[model samples]
Target: MELLGLDSFNLVVRHGGFGAASRACGQPKATLSRRVRDLEESLGVRLIERGGRSLRLTDEGAVLHAQTASPVEAINDALNDIRAGLGRPSGRLRISAPILFANTALGVLAAKFIEAYPDVILEISTEDRFVDLAADDLDVVIRANPRPDDTLVGRCFMRNELVLVAPPGLSRPARVEGSAERLTFPAVMRMGTGDDDVWTIIDADDGLPRRYHPKAVLRLSSPLTIRNAVLAGAGAALVPRTVVAEDLASGQLISWGTASGPEIEVWVLHASRRLVSPKVTAFVNFVCDHFNAPTR
Candidate 1:
């Protein structure tokens, strides 16, 4: 049934007559009467007993008034709430992020976001894959080195580089004979990595690039697991500096060298087809501010 007609019928019932309802709401009496008639026709029930002495309700009208009165009021309240909070961030916002980013920064970022936007209910999921935002019903996503997508838009919030790190006791390898400082070391590597996988590191002092091969002693999938292995003296591995900043500072892990020309670009993204919601906008601003990074 038409909500306007139902509301008009309720108004007429609550006020005792069409004229009274019109006077109370400043609507034309003809409009209220016509809407009530439309409501009755739509419901296939005569609601009001017309041509009565004052205003009388048919049996069906009485039941409709009893059943729909409170529900209509509730619907109106919910609509009003949406209107009132339109300028504010108030809703459920589902987000997807890479696993390593979530493990490193998402917890603290989520805490601050919820504190600032108490109205928004935030749900975050951590996975390493680039998810389909619309298909997954996600409001936002965070990724690293996100492939070019014309359908996605957002800001780059963090830029970091990969570095070779090892336990404090593990010494750097000597340069290979008859080579331009090429070396090999027992290294923890990602699963599926080739045995002869080579890494290039920029020399900190000489500002020259050097090639090194990781003799894979341990192969793990998760970056966090690899970092832990390096800390436990399993072997050296190339990892993101931010992920192991504390370990390097406290002398638990030593940096062998910085990975050559690798920039880890972290981005926050959302679907570009629809209008951005207030909650998503608020979150984007919050993350950019935290990292002091510019929007892409």
Candidate 2:
């Protein structure tokens, strides 16, 4: 249980400098330096390589850090699991997610989590851009098709299926075929990442994927704007199942095609650490359990 020293090392890597790490960790620079030195002496291998004013991890340090992070995080998760088993979740949980998901899904889950753990502080940020969880002081990031680094941890939270939806005024094409199916009205595209145009549908009977190419009319990264546009009678759109759930339930929008579509997996991600304290662990467990609930 080299918990304390491993945490300091992880902080130094996250902050990129001793001074910044000291400030973030609320420790004096001298004290942090001594702690790291003691850790190096205890391990008999240099963890941080001096790079003028900045510090870089030695090859051995990188491997050691990576190997130790998950266990540290698991320790933290274990503590939280114990606390949750006893019916108490008390800690701070920081989260970041896409604007659409943050507003629609996480908002509800966060509220429920806070209610369950009244002593826990749930900080959430809604940004479409990606943030480094370790560096940005973030505990978890919910992302679609998240590709975590070797030093990070990822947990799939939910599965997302993309579907084409349009306003009531849009006309249904007489013949819908393969990826080249031509629709009469222009399509509103969620222009995030480069794969917006590559719309796919899954064959319900065979459970195989089929692609579709729509006539592009509007291209924007904001899913909210696309939803609003579709609601205001712009055109058809390929959007997340969660994003359109309420509107579809309310009959504001309708599913466009018969074939099913591609599935985008959503994940909860966090930095790899040697020791996950009670706070971080509790949050991860709570989030996973919350999202994995029967209603979810």
What are the Cα lDDT values of the candidates? 0.84, 0.71
In the range 116-234, model 1's lDDT, one tens digit per residue, is 98888898998987588754557789999999999889998899999889897897886666777658889999998998788998764566677888899999999999999998889
Q: Which digits, one per residue and each the tens of the lDDT, describe model 2 over residues 97-139?
A: 8877777777778777777668778888888786876445666
For residue 208, give model 2's deviation from the true position in Å: 11
Q: Candidate 2: which stretches are off by over 4 Å? A: 1-89, 176-181, 192-212, 258-261, 293-296
The clash count of every prediction, one per candidate, is: 0, 9
* TM-score of model 1 vs. true structure: 0.71
Clashing residue pairs in candidate 2 (N, C-alpha, C atoms within 3 angstroms): 69-273, 69-274, 72-274, 72-275, 72-276, 76-276, 201-261, 202-260, 202-261
In candidate 1, residue 88 scores what lDDT?
78
TM-score of each: 0.71, 0.63
lDDT of 1: 0.84
